[model samples]
Target: MSTVAVPELAVVSSPWSLGPLHLSNRVVMGSMHTGLEVQDDGGAGMAAFYRERAAGGAACIITGGIAVSDEARGGPDFAVFGVGGADERFRAAVDAVHDEGSTILAQLFHAGRYALAAGMVDRHGAPQRVVAPSALPWAAARGVVPTELTAAEVERTIEDFAAAARSARDTGFDGVEIMASEGYLINQFQSPLTNLRDDEWGGSPERRRRFTVAVVEAVRAAVPDLAVTIRLSGADLMPGSSTDDEVDALVHDLLPLGLDGISVGIGWHESRTPTVQAAVPHGAWLAYASRIARVVRASDHPEVRVIASNRMTDLRDGEAVLADGLLDAVALARPFLADPAIVDRSLAGSFDLVNTCIGCNQACLDRSIIGAPVSCLVNPRAAREVAFPARPTTDPKRVDVVGGGPAGLAAAVDAARRGHHVTLWEASDRLGGQFDLAALVPGKEDYAATVRAARAELADRGATVHLGHPATVADLAGSDAVVVATGVVPRAVDVPGADLPHVLSYEQALRDGVPAGTVAIIGGGGIGVDTAAFLTESPDEARRATEFGARWDVDVAETVVGDVPQRLPAAHRTLRPGPDVTVLRRSGKFGQGVGITSRWVALGRLRDAGVRMVGGVQEYLRIEPGVLWIRDEHGDEVGVPADSVVVCAGQEPALPTGDEADGRPTDGLVTGLQAAGVPVAVVGGARDARSVDAVRATSEALEAVRRLAP
Candidate 1:
């Protein structure tokens, strides 16, 4: 691999004056729910989290939804603007970002009926009824219906937005962005599918947009001196929702309002389309952005900047969209979580040095929807910066780290950066243990960037890395400390047909190859699901936004952009299914360990690929020449014909090879290191491997290395 992959980021690195707010660059750290806002310290913890990203090089920081009203909160964990001590904390956070020379914007938010929040109550402690334009229940909210805001209450809600903007201006925010996208309060009022009222809020398309337009008008009046913007659902992606023409009409209405910016956001929270997931291609929503940009530019107020956001990761890709001279900026949310210094690194012409976001959502989104503090899988230091500040060690010594997987690589990086002499050994020829195999899965090519980042970081810190070298007790005899991150090996499924030649482990299927023809997968864990996905390389995996819109029954005459919904008319070829794949679990949910935010998207891909999933395996009978017999719950014999069977039952901790001289079978090198009066640390899969998780692995490694003394 080369030292770096430089990005063409001229437009993104250039400064721009967005109305009253003069930004340092076009790379905006878009709003995301960090869960630190509602912490007991008010906003102190969140301030530290934001301060780091601003200092790292985000030009403008958009805060996660700051609740405008208690009843409209996204969740119970969201901090209401003037409630409790939030005002004081917001002021402190503003000062922190300003000290870093970055502009911060407070995004006034209201979740409406899409409140995934539970047990929400008002200031008086009575149960709060989630309010919306109509009394409709959010599809994913588990039958929780919202109260229809009376015409008077609707006016009050508009007032709430204005008050929040005034509070934000007084609290020292450089700008205010209205959170109207993602199926929130204002967006609910804009879409006819959710806003079914016959009143002034939702009779026609124009009336449906009245709520959002009024809020924008009020917010601008409250914060006349600050840069004001509103994030709008460019397509909404919902069936029977606002169409392209309707959204364009709304844009024209807002253009005359002299708003500072108009950000085009794609996909509502209830929409079936995959918005920011790994399956979605990079720059997927640029076309939606272009539509709004053209509308804004042709309007009377071209000075009102247009911003594109969604499924964007690279600065160069963002600049590519900006090079057309239509879009004023690009908004990125999760990528900043992966690498806060993404802009600074790219501007310095070292894009490869930046830790790219793989769109796994395991650490960030999965945690946020559950009201937990959001962190990054690739960069575990995010959100916990105050608790785990990076500091140089007073004393340095030799540190031998066994296993060059996620845990070991993380240990080496942490130790080396702290002034320790670090050495890493991996039994395999490659560094990434599971990540290398994971990268082979469709839509997961970014997994390879993690390996590249670890390798580059280790090399830069002068850490010794030995591939295909398994560390033994003798190898760690002279080390000050040892991190046994040897990782896990496949757990065999005990059954009559376990030894069949057709049976391949998950590792084998990923590395060697998945055999051609029909395939059967045993186990429905995350690995099993991914293996099944890898087995069938159907055209469905390459589905673009047009197909996504078509599948969801969305009207996309001018809304969606990308590959056409159907194969090119000139091809004149019928689509063929890739392969016949089946996943059989003993008795558990499919994609069990996968995050909620991405599990449905993965399952939907499998359905499109024609992959069948079968759960409730009563018993495994035997394997014949080309069929595996099994017993169902009804005691009926069934045979699944398959040319290959891959077992993804899971993994177990693996100790290093040839390291049990004293017959201490379980503790191999760890026992030797401990008995020799040398410090020893057993972390990651080497300690417990009931499951595979890079988040837990890296966090464990950080704490283990931090506790280790020379």
Candidate 2:
């Protein structure tokens, strides 16, 4: 890894073959459930989405879980093979990818017990009963238990996979990968924890393998000419589940099923392992892939390719893993969302230009928690490629983007790319307003990389950037139009004694490490959680999976023995070594405003670090020397002992106000600029400062630049 060079990444672009299917490169995109699948346009939107990624350099793209049957649907937007208009969607996606000179694979899926049965209905518009190998509830299910599948019903499910594969083949798919991993129906049968039945589909390890083996054999028999593959779980990562011997034996048994490839996935959806979050190290699951590859490559069918998936955010890490020659390919899903041209740029030795996925999950995974279309935090035009076409602007204008924050930088890059003569103005000495500050926190180191990439992008696009030069109203008179992205300013805490010398802001605590003493965070939003993490950690210790394992006292390399809570592994973090940190919130969720997928991970780490979280603060009595008093929700006065008080109450819009009585201008800067005859487009927090969301900021900024006046 230490010797891996940037040029060597061309290996990912090297052509590879899986059985009869020949791919253009080794870089493959795993399936991602973009909520666009269930659209009524006969998959026109999903097709465009895939076409854009393919054009951007995705070689072999796997379609998000296409339900084999209506009962197999995972959530609200699953595109079922034979249900409703899903086939139209599947056909459109296949045609779209093939039109781009790339290949597509239909991932035949079944949610089993993981399906939200309460919200879904069958083709007949009746409640689709959730069923699994055994009548068991998923660990995350809210009092929803699946009905046990009968032996005949299990056979029908296997045939459902076969039927789905045939539909895909007819629709012109290059391959079909059985969704047998991720605690899905097939995975449910493989693990004893979920399959507690004594029936033929579950009884023993051999019987457990029967369901998966049947699925593979049926799907292969259905589409023998297509590149048949399956995403199998190399490690269930669940305590009291299948053992290493069982998983390895399953991989070996599948080799005889005429499969073209096996992409080894890690952990079940309910597994108590932190495999995909930001805290996990890049390439953390490569060993598991290597483990499966050993069983595949050494078998009689040696040519069957094996792919390593999960947590490989950067293609360089994928290249490094492939350089070892243990695995045939690497599968990354979210990285492609960040930058569709990630592979092409990396292979061209322009890796720095790629907008890498930092594994934040703020935009992709978190949005999925609420059934929203997955987009990228860095690249706002991800799934909405058709809506936000990247075509060069027809009428380019002299665009001046104010404030060098994420919003402003995004607006500048977008405007410059659209062929506008762009000039960016920043009041501060540096760019990357919030991003630069976010980079100071451990495990968020890739944020700095984003900033660097944005700066380089701006320079490459020939945009003039001015540091330490705050553009006055008159300074922007030369511009055809102005984009005001002046982000936000941290709001001052209004509590009594908030002005005390010991009371510091979140920016201050993050920029300058807190003093060596007890620290109390007043708010528990995103910044407060980060501040708590920053204060409790010592730079002397490591972060990532290694740090996470040490802090939580869990073995990242091995599975835990019991179904104790699913604790995260890995993330460059420290234990209870530095100042004692406490996060107190007035009310609501402790990790509110944080992404759904990330909030739990952040709060879990905080708990593991001995950070006391106090919610239901009715009153902030006063901030004294060594203690801050507060009223609890139960009308109790509580003393929050602290040596330093950090305010994480949030931020407000940083915009100058103008004369509203004239009705000629909205804000002072915009009014002044407009009076000078300079058209203005207000964006980011400057328009309306509610919360500091990089997603909303970048999205709105790009939209602003897109609609900028001529």
Candidate 3:
């Protein structure tokens, strides 16, 4: 076996050195929801998940927040550390981490008032009162209120943190990170927005710091060898909450407690601060880290280390912060999800191949909300490192991959990594297919970057990336296997006047440009809605509409047959961010297809932007020049004026070759691969490819069996 050289990664020689215990590397994988704890084997899957990260070179891995007690747990799916007392299963979790040559840390946390009261009501078969520092409604979900915690209850909470730390040490963990950020229970006690207690745990800044300090002291006493990392909300960044000066004072006071390190994080649960956005530069929260670091560094106490987190993606930026003495180490969350071997890639100087997490917050947090395992849009093996470790193929057969979207790139890369000589053919000049257009959208540059990174990685890994080639059977001849990733195309509507010169498809516009003029978009799906929002000009409007550019009252066309199309569930829809735009409904009914939550937000944006509504229209035709003829509900045609007609209508799979074998749509590249008798797998948005991963794995497994046949 050849040793891979990784340079960019900060080597941690000891876990205790960083915190209470020495660490091996500076890379700390952030906590994420894996949904693996709920596996039938009782955290067996979860153990494997952590083991992979540890094997990948994480010195210390922090498991997703666990409930100190039952009431604090989000659900049965959440990993419980100390609930029902620490047991053998918990020890198994710790052993799993240690067995991989890395230390494990458990986050001690409580939801307090933020606990899901409704969820608890359903689970317990009765309603339960939500507890917090004060009787404040959960800001995100209104009408669900929490009762204030008493002074005694506050003391108990501190004890809970200490007990959790003891559990960590007992369970063989390196240490515990006190949950004091993101407006959790500890955060509620620290923030004035949630904590309105009049006693020693609330009301005054000194009192608020009391609970945090006590938790630190108790945990330190409980596990003197275990590193105790404090995740602090340096600046709540919320109105009427703890200010920067108060945070500074709090950290300074805690510095003498012999803490291991302080991971400075900003933003509270109810914060209006934009944590992830293009407007905010990378490593935007370095200032907050620097502030706390300054306090700890300047203090007489010498044990505590300062760790910088929050939007730290680039190595140069992280090094800059470390070089500037702002932080001792950098904690990366989403970036790790994108590439677990980020340290290796950085050390290899393959920054181009390192998937730059665009802060999309899509596969990471968004998927977590739906109870799906956290995943990465760019790196396919991110969370599946153990389940799908890179292995050499037994057959060493040739493989061909068609299309170059995320799924295709992943399949090709995996196949190549398995020691197969692979050919990746893209019909277009570039590798990324439909995703190429996605990169043009504002704030979506990450999508493009991910595509570029995948392409570069494939190239470096020795996959033949053949641009400007459409895969065909003749071209794929004799290939052991073929992987098809032919992506989806725009959905079209059969409405009249669809062929006008001004009527432009979203793909065409992205490939070309949406000329600066009046424009109307037909669909209100994510693409359509996003297109409509992007066409408008002006920053305020873009923010309001959440579109690409600043909001400008540009000439735009929006097709409404008086009714909105369905498929736009408010839960999944992204509302246009600005005004200076209009929506024309085909009928009087608005948001017929949009989801309730998304509809409210989108329609609210449209109404706020002064979008014009055109209803009860029929027989949309080209009437005169520069106008669309629309017949009313009564069959009366009227001319609606417009400068450009933009089509955001849906799409269908446009097969490059009309090859229907045996009276069926040929399974395309996937079919071709199987026919070629090569092992293959598919992934990503292509539903057909989901099953391919299993097939490829099984095929490789069978090949191994054959190779060993006597």
Please rank every candidate by lDDT, starting with the best. 1, 2, 3
Across residues 233-262, which tens digit of lDDT does each residue of candidate 1 receive?
888888888889999999998887759998
Cα lDDT listed for each candidate: 0.81, 0.80, 0.62
- lDDT of model 1 at position 82: 72
Q: lDDT winner among the candidates?
A: 1
lDDT for 511 in candidate 3 is 61
Candidate 3 on 1-710: residue-level lDDT in tens?
A: 01243433333222236654666556677666666644455456567667666666666777777777655655445555543323455576678888877787788877776676465542344554567778887655447777777777767777877777777777777778888887877777777777777887877889988888888898888888777888888677677878888888888878888787888776765554455443233555666777777777778975578877776665555656665444677777777777666665665567787777766555556556545676665654555555565567667867777778666676676677777887888888886665576565543445666777877877887888878877666577666666566666666557566776777788876566655445555644556554554454222312333331122221111110012122223332333333323344454345543322233444444554556555555545552345556675678867555565666545655445644433455566556546655454443334332222222332332233222210
All candidates in order of TM-score, best leading: 1, 2, 3
Candidate 3: where are CA atoms >4 Å away? 1-16, 82-93, 96-101, 117-129, 139-143, 277-280, 385-387, 532-641, 659-710
Q: Which ten contiguous residues of candidate 3 have the minimum total lDDT? A: 555-564
* Overall local distance difference test of candidate 2: 0.80
The candidate that achieves the highest TM-score relative to the unseen native structure:
1
TM-score of each: 0.93, 0.92, 0.80
> What are the per-residue Cα lDDT tens digits for candidate 2 across 118-140?
77788888988899888889766
Ranking 2 against 3 by TM-score, winner: 2
In model 2, state the lDDT of residue 673: 81
